[model samples]
Target: MTASRSDALFENLLESAQRLSFDSRSPQLYELESGDDERHGMTPEWSPLYGTPLWNSLTEQERARLTRNEVAQFLGVGIWLEVGLQVALLRAGHSADPSRPDIKFLFNECADENMHSLMFVGAIEAIGAKFYQRDRALDFFGWIFRHFVWDEVAYGVVLAGEEIFDVMQRDWMTDEDVAAPIRRAAYIHVVEESRHMAFARRKIRDRLVGLSRIRRAVSTLIIAIGTHLIAKGMINRRVYEDLGLDWEVVRANIDGNEHHRMMFRRAAEPFIEFLSKEGLLNFGARWIYRKSNLL
Candidate 1:
């Protein structure tokens, strides 16, 4: 409960997770194989390399809009909340016997996430885009990382996001109307998340459930913070901004007043349902869904 304990927990978790970086077969390999799919569809649609663009497509306007979306999608929403949870969990494992495979899997996942951010930025650059941090929704979930958080809560928050993201990627793979660029993104994610989600379910079931009471309490608080962060990130803003729509007006259209919370809920709904049906719906899990206004 002390700050020192918390800091130590984070450090250990990160160290364990870092083990994956040295693993021979990482999602990074899949990314490397994804060469020039944007220019030619030589790879299968399900391949992680299916639609990777070269660095030459963006005009100034297009790049700017893409950069905004990238900041919102990767940095603001994904990295700060999702990857941050992994770091928190790694730290928590310091005092306990953390699963090496799980930590490694998570580390690999972090690598994938980092690559995804790079890929998004690369796509923007291919089209010639630049981004300004000021345009990001900075205050949206600034409260989540203000204090130490527990592992269970952190895991649940991460699991919920993964579930939502996985579902989105699956949909994109199946959608006939999805653009090539989006499909490429989906392909890479699906390949990685297939393992990540499986790992999450096991980690939560086996590892998280066995933690001490103090850890459980911390987990709950972390999950709550994660839930709120996710809820705030679901609005489709950059598209509207690209079209010169007022931010408020776009929010109104996407999340009309009481219905303003719908986007996050709808996106997270399948995960909520899955957890409930699987009997994995802990307070932390439910808290995440509720924060998204899904349950």
Candidate 2:
């Protein structure tokens, strides 16, 4: 991964950013149909409880509400990570040489994330869904992630989070059944994040070159653990209560549903393969990934 390649990527990203930037406050966002009692506020297949007995038993209105809430919660996780990333990014790039192309692009990336968080918050609020909070321990870790991490580790975590979110959002952007406002948001995120992920992956590769096997192995486990937390944190328990379903029961069913598991496996396949080829998917880290059902 040459600095020249990074410079080209950054140049392209900068041009893309200039040509396309948006706010969450657009009238189109406000015009989103009330999907509360409708059939498709979100693509039904993405509901956390999808393919479970609970999902099959849900009424049309209930299903709509659940999927809408599920999508909101997914975006909620992005909001959580993005907030922390804003800090991490600033600190990481704070000392970069101004002459480097990626330096300017780093600040541009930060601005993009700021807008994305606002967009997610606006969409969730518009849909009347809750942006659930992480537990105390996770919150503390999240704060640490937001405030301190950078370098190869931050980009490692960044790629894990972005890849999963990108895969899902890419599907939404093309699926007609997904809500229009949500699709628009997804499209914006996917486009911008493609550049971010490319940049992060390159950074990881560059930094990994001289790291010892022990350090790489340790970092791999940490990255896998971080991803596991993010994956498990996506669906808030309260999203089920709107349908009068028990969270524990619904979660149990979702855990057992081959359909949902397969979805995750498929989405994570390329990412896992990439990490494995790069030697970041070691034995210990593989176990953590399996625990999260992303294996």
Candidate 3:
């Protein structure tokens, strides 16, 4: 689509986003930045799906190491990226038309994202863990403002990221290990994010359908990022660094290794397979993955 058309589509989505309301059952924190869970005492939250056996399976060293590092990673990347991006994207995509539906939906989405981040951070802090203060992945996405002041590409990336979180939300909210308050929070988030995911997919799909070339480029970029960022979804780096592995070597292993291809595919394979089976994987997407050898 042309810039003007893309802008219009964004406006519509933003209008809808602003109108989404939260379930009354969700939790709240009196402090925005304090990472403390007011409902439950300071205990590390884990999905029941991660059985106690699995929890016990980890050695004490592994448990403590992950308790800090992995928690930090979750707070930094997941919270900031998901919450911070929504408001920024909405402000950028807002239109002059007050009646625009997308803007309304986006507003609700931003609110939901903010609440989600606060709860997530609070949970991290509840266990006496530190906030993820330094993360290159989060930094890189934050810095993309120089390229396009209000780029849809950035918005689309955040939407895709939310889908990843949605899966965990669905699984963990229902699992037995989650605390009652936290489970309520997850359930509320799952409902709100469901709408956000639909809008995100619509915005990207419509944008792609308008331009075969851009569609191909977007699909390729999403695949590449999916591979590098979320493939393993493991805490290997924190482990390696804690073990005194050279930071550079650890970074190289994570960044340069081919094994991440599997990880990426594992994380995204379900989505792609769903699209393919639904016959929504178009020629452009096929071409992009075909050239990348991701088929």
Candidate 4:
């Protein structure tokens, strides 16, 4: 895409953001009606243990607790990813021309992400769950990306994370079976992230032009590794352990769960296709994606 086209795209995004922005302190976020505690924190079909014999053995209350923990893990990881994106956006703005439409859109996106993180925190708290700690190794890599990466690589990583969450949130937001706070937060995130994703895709497409083959390969590998870490880190083993289940057994069930794998692949499909068309799905990257069960 040409520079003018890119500018126009971001200008449009900025307008939408300005018009649809919401307050994080809205009272609707705190009001929970009767029986809200009994609702699932996410769609039941998206549960990692769904359809497993072990899952079948759990009582309704136990199942609800497990889903709550799982949702907390997702929200916690989302907070981590959002913080990283905010850092990357600030870093990009530091060296960018303030007059650029893309930079303005990114700053707006950073503000949106801050509110989204707050919403995730509130949702996790409302679910009566604690944040799950990410794997140390993934945290280290996130630190590197937050501090140094830029251009297409930065936007690619951001896009991958957002796209995965977007898919799940689209389901959660509209599912009446989900908790009210979770559903509301998901709705806000899905709406706002639509603009962010558009901006990221346009940036990635614009930045990838004329890139050297070797650099593209390296960038592809980095994005794949980041995505693999994200997928692996989304569900913490502590979630099962805290719920009084053996981590090993739960891990085994999840590994063999075709339903869970299919959900992941479905979540990744659009982004995977985009990467392929952008020439970012080289052999190494494709292998990583397959290992992550995202391909």
Candidate 5:
């Protein structure tokens, strides 16, 4: 991308951030309805166990409870990703010229991410759902990524997470069957993250302009691995145990879940297409994505 085009993108993103920002503490955002207990915490079809015999056997209340924990797991992972992104942005900003429009936008994005984390935390609390335990391996990978990854690789990984969540949140925000708090949070996230995704895409495209073939291949593999970890980390096996279900059975069901696999592909399709067009989906990356069930 040209410098002029990049500058314009940042300027427009910054303008939107100024005009459309929201306070996560707004009481209206957390308003609950009388029958909220009847609602799913996420779209039921997105559940890993959806269409399985176990899922069919559950009472509506039981299913709702499971979905509540499932969505909370997603929100919890989102918060973790947002925090890592913020750290990466701040580190990038350290040596960057503050006068640059992109740097300004970076700081603005950090502020937005902070609010998003707060919104996720509040939503998890509102639904009376517990957060999943941290995966130490993923946490270590996040640490390495935030501190070391840069340019196309960094932005590509960020875009993958944002895009996957964006697809799901678009569904959750509009689904009347979803919980009120989750819907409200999803709405806010979808609105703000549109700008973030645009910025990441532009950065990835620009950064890849003259990258060496070897570097591009390495970056592609790293991004694919990061995406795989993110896909796996979104749902904790503990969610099943906490809900009084057998983790092995749930894992088996998820592994065999054509519906769940289809949902993953649907959520990831846009990013996969974008990556392919950018020449980031080499043989190795494609294999990783397939294993993640996101191809």
Candidate 6:
């Protein structure tokens, strides 16, 4: 478009960024310590094994242990995702006009995400938890995503990660019973990510105009698979072992866990609705989401 239009878009984005920017340095951001109860890590209903026989078999203490480990694993995954997003966003910004609003907001996003990583790491360390690595088998997708931001597909990929977690964090922040530390972290993420999600949605929708149906179909499948894998990877099988739970039994429960399925579905609602509105959630993509139980 015109130089004036890009400058206008950038100005609006930068204004929002300056208005909502957060500081990770506040002493209040890190005041909670996990004592006997680790409920702060996660709510019981969020556990993968919640509502299963295995979950019923555990004492409250044991449940807290599991929650702690499970939450830590997710934060580890957050670190991984935020790291990738920061890299990809920075790289994608290279083609932007350095003086434009998009580039400035892109850099702002990177800064926000870096602070998020530090906050997540602080939470993990405070819980005395270990980080879980992503399943390397899917590294190729990461490579493709990192290298390919030319299409609107790239922002859609970014939104998938943000929206899924955004929903969950929204829930956490609202629940009065959630621990302050977790609540605070979720609160921070929810606030800042609201802006990021808005930016991503705007970018995707604006860029999707005039795209061919064939390309949209292909990107839809790629995004579906990416979302499925990202959701699956967050469970972190090794976390069960770390918590002294049998992976086999835990896996069995998670496979058919109605609560887990519901959680996935609920968390995905806004994302699915947005994509549906955009006409990206086509028949083939719907089938994939059904297979993943995220529809």
Range of the 10 consecutive residues with the lowest summed lDDT in candidate 3: 40-49
User: Candidate 6: which stretches are off by over 4 Å?
Assistant: 1-10, 33-38
Q: TM-score for every candidate vs. truth? A: 0.59, 0.92, 0.62, 0.97, 0.98, 0.92
**Deviation from native of the Cα of residue 125 in model 1, angstroms:** 3.6
TM-score of 3: 0.62
The numbered model that scores best in lDDT is 5
RMSD of each: 9.6, 2.0, 7.3, 1.1, 1.0, 2.3
Tens digit of per-residue lDDT, candidate 2, span 1-295: 4767767877887788788777666767645654433535457776667878878887777777778878877887787788777678778777778767887888887888888888877766666666665556567778778776657778888788889888888888777776666777888888888878877787788789889888887788878878888888776676676657787898798888888877777767877987987889988888888888799
lDDT of 4 at 66: 91
Give candidate 1 misplaced runs (Cα > 4 Å).
Answer: 1-76, 93-99, 127-147, 174-176, 208-222, 236-242, 257-266, 277-291
TM-score of 2: 0.92
10 residues in a row with least lDDT, candidate 6: 32-41
TM-score of 6: 0.92
Tens-digit per-residue lDDT, 77-154, candidate 6: 776778777777778677777766777778888888899988887766665566766677446667777777454666
**Candidate lDDT (C-alpha), each:** 0.50, 0.77, 0.51, 0.89, 0.91, 0.78
Model 2 backbone overlap count = 0
lDDT of 5 by residue, 1-295 (tens): 3989999999999999889989998877777877887899999999989999889999999999999999988888898899998888788779888989999999898888989998888887887887988688789999998899787878888899999999999999999999899999999999999999999999898888889999999999999999999999986988989988998888888888899999999999999999999999999999999999999
lDDT of 1: 0.50
The number of clashing residue pairs in each candidate reads: 15, 0, 26, 0, 0, 1
- Stretches of model 3 off by over 4 angstroms after superposition: 1-57, 60-69, 145-152, 178-182, 212-215, 230-267, 274-295
Q: Positional deviation of 66 in candidate 2, in angstroms?
A: 0.6
| lDDT assessment of candidate 2 | 0.77
